[model samples]
Structures are given as structure tokens and as C-alpha cells.
Target: MSKQYRILGVIISLAIGLAILPIKLTSEDLHSGNLFLAARTIRYTFTAGILAFLLHLYLNRTIFAARWIMVEYILRIIVIALIICLTSIVVDAIFNKFVKESSFTIAKEDLNWYLVILRCLLVSTVQFFVVFYLQLVEESQRRRLEIEKLNRSQLEANLSNLKEQMNPHFLFNTLNTLSAITNDVKVKDYVSEIANVYRYMLIHNKLNLVLLESELSFINSYLYIIKTRFGNSLNINIRIDESILPTKIPPLSLQLLLENAIKHNVASLDSPLAIDVYNDSENIIVSNSLLPKKTNYHSTGVGLNNLLNRYQLLFKQDIIIEQNTAVFSVKLPIIKS
Candidate 1:
């Protein structure tokens, strides 16, 4: 509803309540001779109009909370009654010159102005609560929308990070294999391994997950390139069960772990490195013996961090990492398609 219409509605409701107050207050039937009744009605109309405008300000603008509803209602009742009674007495005194005033007073009989004030209080309290409830509902909906927006932004950031990591990893390994092939005479086998590895990485790197068998075959082709380059030094053992070959796993996940192993560990013909790949109870396991490479440059630790971030983005679960005196292992959960 428009603001103007809502303001008009409040005015109409107050006018009706003020109009009815006089008839309800009179002990006898409402009649023309009852000057007091008419005067009281005019006084109430002025008081209620002022109170309604003040209430609109309080309900919409005030930051204070009503901790004690009963106390608030009682105070409002007292204030409205005092304002109306004072206005009525002044209006009666002013009308003495223009018209005759009623002399039949109710000093002998007892009256309770508190009851009428309480009735007005109940109506005002109900209006306040309705407005408060609607505002709370609007705030709740706004917060929910904000949370969804944050989640979408986080997912986009993770996807971009994962995309960026795959390219450099493939480039460095391919170039290294090419450099090794320059000195050796195994051109045909080296070229074949490079072709197979590049073809698979290009096709699957952008995807979130691929079948366990497909990822394994890609990892095997990658290991082939690494092994051909390192020749007699890189030892890889696969212990996968054929039963879960169709399950889904993150694309190029195994290749990343294998790269980390080769980058950080020592591997030569004299002390050949051992790397193991297997699956156990819905997880892919990659473990390698610790033999730090003295000649390699220090890494900035982006590979493992990238893997952790991607796993959290896709699964909302932590990948298990365990390291001890002789071995370091990582366990990745398999997500079934």
C-alpha cells in the first residue's frame, strides 16, 4: 500500500473510536440535551488524533524496545485520559459565552475513567505489535538472501582457483619430459606419453568429477611421462580394486598428489623412490616414503592448498592427511555418481 493510504487508514480508525467513546461513556441514552457528552467526544477526538500521530512515529521510527508491555499500555492510558480531561474542562469554560452549559454534574456518583483509557490502550497496543511483527519478518527474509549471495560468491572463487592450478601443473610436467627426451633417444615413447597426457588433461580438467577408472588411466599416462623422464628412479605401484572403478572422483586428483611426491622427494637410481596408489572403504589413498630432494628448489605450497580448497568447495569435507617419521599419506573421499 502507498504511504498516503496507510496514513489515511490510521486517521479513519482513530476517528471511529473517538466517535463511539461518548455514546459508550454516557449512563443514559445519547440525547441532544447531554452537552457534557458532546464536549467529551470533541475532547477525545483531539486527544486520539494527537496520540495516533505520536504512535505512528514511535512504531516506525523509535529504536527502543517495549520490554514490559503491560507497563507501556498503562502509561499510555494514563497520559491519554489526563490530556482528554484537561481539554474537556477548557473547552467547556470557553463555550460559556456562546452557549448554555449543563449544570447537572455527576459529582455525587462514582466514575472510572481508567476503564475507558484501558480500552484505548488495548487497541493501540495491538496496532504496535502488528507493525513490529511485519518488520521482523522482512529483516529475516533479507538476511536469508544475503547468506545465499555469499555462498554463490565463494563457489565462484573456488572454481576459478581450481581452473588456474591445472594449467601450470600440466605445462611444467610436459616441459620437463620434453627436456629429458632431448638428451635420450626414446623420442617415440616420450612423444606418445606426452600426447596421451595432454589429450586427457585438456578434455577433463574443467570438469568437477570423472569416473575412477578414467581418472586412474589419466594418472597412469601422467606417471608414464614422469617415469620415462626419471627413468630407473620413479617407482609407482597401483593396488586398485576393479569393483569400484565406476565410482566418481575429482578430475586429475591422483596426478596432483603424484606430482607433489615427485617434486619434494629424492629419487635416483641409487635410492629409487616408492609411491603407492590404492582405494580403501570409499577413499583414494596416495602415500610415499620421505626422502627429501636436496637439489630441488623450495616450493611455495600452492599444490596442497589448491587441493584442499577444491575439496571443500565440492564436498564441504576435509581431506585426510597423515605424516609420520617415514611416510606421508593423503586420503581423498570418492563421490559416487
Candidate 2:
């Protein structure tokens, strides 16, 4: 605990002690008169306040670790009541032994144990609520911090993905392809498709989720660029249900998967790279044949990892990956808008 909170506790204890002084003085008779009564009231108030403060401190730590709310609260209340009862008995005994004609003696046969227990129970109940409210405030603050941290991390990831997409290598490769295509008509079309791909990236990269139809349309433009570069060596098949078109997904998810397939696998006239995109009942499935290249592709695994993080942050869902000697596949959960 900070010095500030400790000071607050002291102030609160003193305030509570002052508040109960009148009740204690009025309820008991002091043979020595008002001075003795006042002294006893001060002692009683101080004891109660200290007990309450100590109970709060102990519970502040224990309550967070406790499971089963009802059981924990019941146990805490019983413990608090017992502590208060024992402390009151001790205080009363001290006063009876030293103070002349102190009426608040627990040793007396007429001393009402029922009222003592009732008072202890009432105080414990109030203490329990105070601790409960503090716990709620602590929990709310913790949640707010977690949300802020998550948002910061998510923004960084989005920026990294955008940088990856706009890298000079990708732009250079597309320009290189355009330069080699001698036909003016086809060159114009390819340039248009490349523009569309980058335009989509610029527009939707910052968003958490985009409509499935919009993503599909973006992927078509992305594929057009890829197909222009690879020609007959690459083949992509897409089969999606129109009903799921209105669903939402992380932008560029399909494009990332497709890029991963192309980057890591062999694509040629002899051995064409085959990729399939379709919708299962609950997921959008992306599967490609596992044809490894002789020269291993340098990959940092950032794209798929970023996609995983985005999926978890957005929907609390995991993208399923299935792989074997012949095929590699991923199942992205279709989140409803």
C-alpha cells in the first residue's frame, strides 16, 4: 500500500471512531462520571476503528485470490465477527478491572451476549461491503489498463502489416511484371488491378474487420496481380456461399494466406501451385497443395502471427491450421457482423 492510502485509512478510522463516540457514552454508565465515560468511549472507538482497518487490509489482499463468492464472504464475515467479539470482551474486562463502577463488564451474568454478537455481525456486514466496493474499483481499473494495452499493441500490428504490404519489393515486382508485358492493352489492365489492390489495402488496412464480400472482392484484385506475374503456373479456385457475404473478417486475411502459399511453394508448368478458397459451415477454408521449393524461402512468420493476433483481439477465436506431407490448410472462423 502507498503512504496516501495508509493516511486515508487513518483518517477513515478516526472519522468512524468519532462517529460512534456518542452511542458508546450514552449506552453505558460510568461511576466516575463524564470524564471516565469519555475516556472509555475514546478507547472503545479507537479499538473498533483499528479492528475495522486491519480487517480491511487483510481482506484487500485475500478477497481477490478467493474463489466461490458466497463461501468466501461467509467465511470472512464469521472470522470478522469472532475477532470483534473477542476484542470487545477483552476491552470490557480491562475496563471492569481498572475503572470504578464500569457497567460494561462481560464477566457479569447480566451482560447480554446476544446484543454483542448482533453488534459484531452488523459491523462485519458493513466492513464486507466496503471491501467489496474497493475490489470492484480495482477490477475496473485493471480492465481499463488491459484494454488500453491491447489497443496499443493492435495499432502497432496494423502499422507493421501496412508497411509489409507497401514494401519496395512488392511494388518493384509488380512494376517489373508490367515492364515485361509488351501488349499495351494488357499492361493497362494489370496496372488497374495493381492500383485496385493497393487502394483496398490503404482503405481497409486500419480497420479491425471488413465485410466478407469486400474482402473477397479485394482478394480478386490481389489474385489478378499474382496471376499476372505467375501466368499459367498458379491456379486459384474460390467457392463461397452468398449467405455469408455479409459476414465480417480481418482485412487482407485471404491475401496473406494466398501470398504465404505462393512464397513457400513451387509454381511452374510442370508442377502448378493449386489453392482452394471455400466456405465450410462455420469457417472460410483456405487450402493449398504442399509442394516445397528446392530453395527454402526466407520467412519471418510475421504475416500469419499478425493474423492470429488480430483474430484473437477481434473475435476471441483461433484460426485452425491443418497440415500434412501433401496439403496445408487454414480455417478462419466466419464472424457475424
Candidate 3:
């Protein structure tokens, strides 16, 4: 049986044993401090054991079936009481065995089987209350855990949705810039690169992983769009090890880092923001010079928080961020799917 089954058995057993203790103590010979009191108690406890076993069997069947009919409850209590009375009689028989040799004769009469049955019923009712109370507590705990698990799942779903929204928003911004640069035929090849980035994002946005080469190519297309918008004001560079090109990364991760770089820092002709993408050891590092754009609206930190939460769900690691007056950088671990 499972640990839960064992624990439940132990709980029921302890409760029944305690319930029967007072009855055994009040028995005629028990209060007289007879030498065989311990033996009698043990013998009588067998009946309580049988009753407890029956209770477990009945409850195991009824509880999880979502069936709590009044008749079933009444029957279970009756069965439990019968077992207790049977065990009490057995203990009395044993006690009489030792007492037979002595001259102690209290009341010699036929066993009051009806009264014994009534006593069993009363004790069973008490045991039922205790067991029912414990079951309620256990059910409450299970419901609490279920609610917590549901909340966790909902949070993850919400984060995934926000990440999905970000992809299109980023694409719309980039596509708008590409549309404005139609007259510049000299950057046609670069325009194709930007188109390829949108193509990949459109195709693979729902995917969990993409090859590093594919993702980097997408990043280049994305950078092309950013460059078109800022012109000479923004400078971006990439230096990746060819060996790691086949590695897998979460989709649109690099885009979020780039967005953060642009959103927070100034990019202009006077102090052009240079964003770098490269590999150092096992980390994919995106570093940019800290030059805040002299604009009234800076940025809310939600984008990065969403990205960090997304990474945590997928990779179980935080997206490392470092910033100073002159520089700001983020390190994302390259992982294989």
C-alpha cells in the first residue's frame, strides 16, 4: 500500500484504540486492579482492531467515490460497533479464566449482549467523529495544493501570451522602418535580410527552440531594420563561434535583449550606441554602451521581466544583466535542446 494508506490506517487505529480504552477501564474487574488487567485489555483490543479494519475498508470505498449516502454511513458505524462488542466479550472470557481460580465472584449472570451492542454503538459513533474530522482536514489540504498548482499554471500561460505579443509588436516596428526605406536600392540586399528575419519570426514564433545560425540570421534582419530607423546613430555588431551555430536557443530571446539595449540607451549621431553580440565561454553576451536617448519617455522594465520569466520557465536560469554608467550588458546561456 502507499504511504498515504499506511498513515490513514495508523490514524484510524490510534483513534479506535483510544476510544476503547475508557470502556476497558470501566469494566468490573479492571477497576479492581486485577493482575490480569493487561491481558484482558489486550484480548478486548482485538475486537477494536477488527472494527478499525472494517472502518478503513468501508471508508476507502465510499470517500473517493464521491458517495456520502446516509445509509452507507449508518451501516459502517453499525459494523464497527459489532466488532468492538465481539472483542469486548473475548476479553471478558479471558478475564474470567484467571478469575475462576480466585474466590472473587461479583455478579454471575448471562452476558448482556444487547447492552454490549449498545455500548459498541456509542463508542463507534465517537470513533466515527474523530475519523471524519481527520478526513476533512486531509481533504482541505489536498484542495489547497490543487489551487496552488492551478495558479502556477495560469501564471506560466500568461507569460507565454505576453511573449507572443512581443514578437509581433517588435516585427511591426521593424517592418514599418523597412517600408519607409523603399527609395534606397543600395540597401536592397540588407532589406532582403530584414525580410528573412520577419519570415523566420512569423514561421517559428510558436516553436520552443531554433538553431543558433537561424536565430542569429533573424537577429541580423532585425538589426537591419533598427539600423534603417536610426541610420548612423546606431551601430550593431555580431561575432559568434561557428562551432556553436548548430546549438539551440529559445526563439526571440536575442530580439528582447536588443530591444532593451535600444529602449534604455541613447542612439544618435553625437554618441552612437554600439551593441555587440558574441560568445564568451558558454554564454551569449549582448553588451551595449550606456548612452540614454535624450527622450522624455524612457521604458518600463516589464519587457525584460517577461523575458527573464520566460527564460526561467524554459532554462531554469536567470538572464544575467549588468549595468554601469558607461556600459550595459546581458548574458544568456546557450543551451542545447
Q: What are the per-residue Cα lDDT tens digits for candidate 1 across 69-128?
A: 666555654554455455544654465545553443322221355654554554455444
Candidate with the larger TM-score of 1 and 3: 3
Lowest summed lDDT window (length 10), candidate 1: 101-110
Residues 265-287 of candidate 2 have per-residue lDDT tens digits of 99998999999999989999999
Show where candidate 3 strays beyond 4 Å.
1-184, 187-191
Which is the leading candidate under lDDT? 2
**For residues 1-337, could you state the per-residue lDDT of candidate 3 as single tens digits?**
2367546755666556655554334455554576445453455444565465546455744543336566667877887787777767766676676667432332333256666676578767766765676667776887687566545644564566556555666766676687677767746666576667767866776676788888888887888788878999888889999988998887777887898888888788988989999998778999999887667985777767766766665677788999888889988887865
Clashing pairs in 1: none
Cα TM-score of candidate 3: 0.51
Error of 2 at 5 (Å): 13
Which candidate comes out best when scored by TM-score? 2
Which pairs in model 3 have colliding backbones? 266-291, 266-292, 266-293
Give residue 46's lDDT in candidate 1 (0 to 100).
47
